[model samples]
Target: MKLSDLAESQILKAQAEGQFDKLKGAGKPLNLTADGGSAEAIGFRIMAEAGAVPREIDLQKAVQEQALVLKETEGEDARKRELKKLADLQMRLEMEREARRRFFGE
Candidate 1:
């Protein structure tokens, strides 16, 4: 038999055996962003959900957390510090995103 036919046969056998049932997000729509960029976004989203995000995505997450903290901060001095930290993290995240875009020609 041809290789493609063999593969299809195996897939059909697995399906009949219910080996693909009850998988995560089985009935849910994919959470893809509207950016319509490279498939890396989907990959990154999956990794992020598993707490294994890449450095750039991790930095972006940190920036978001810091922004929330800054909003809740009360003291002027503390808020200023949080703002500075948030700015630094945002800059780093932006740089990493640009580098990836250029490298992937996205």
Candidate 2:
């Protein structure tokens, strides 16, 4: 059978069994405005619901923290190390943005 046919049959069976009777928002109107039904928005919404963040976002945070560390470094050696680390994080963030732009055409 076709995928849609199978899906419809499953839904009908569940409805017959009253399996969806108590589902949350069962009779409520859908809130499609929240994500606008885009793949990126839907992915972000699901990630946020699961307490997760995108890799680029995490990398940006790391870059900020590294900057702070670089600023606080006292010795020349430590300063150089921290500056390198900060540069690396920033480069990684840029690469991530480029990759996403190429792959998702975002």
Runs of candidate 2 with Cα error greater than 4 angstroms are 1-45
Tell me which residue pairs clash in candidate 1: none
lDDT score for candidate 2 against the true structure: 0.82
Tell me the RMSD of model 2 versus the true structure: 7.6
Write candidate 2's Cα lDDT for 1-106 as tens digits.
Answer: 9766897998799799997677655688656677796767766665565566889879988999998888888999999999999989999999998998887667
Estimated TM-score for each candidate: 0.56, 0.58
Index of the highest-TM-score prediction: 2
- Pairs that clash in candidate 2: none
lDDT of each: 0.80, 0.82
Poorest 10 consecutive residues by lDDT, candidate 1: 29-38
- Candidate 1 segments whose C-alpha is farther than 4 A from its true place: 1-38, 45-52
Predicted candidate 1 versus true structure: per-residue lDDT over 25-75, tens digit per residue: 667877556426547877676566656668896797799899999999999
The TM-score obtained by model 1 is 0.56
Q: Best by lDDT, which number?
A: 2
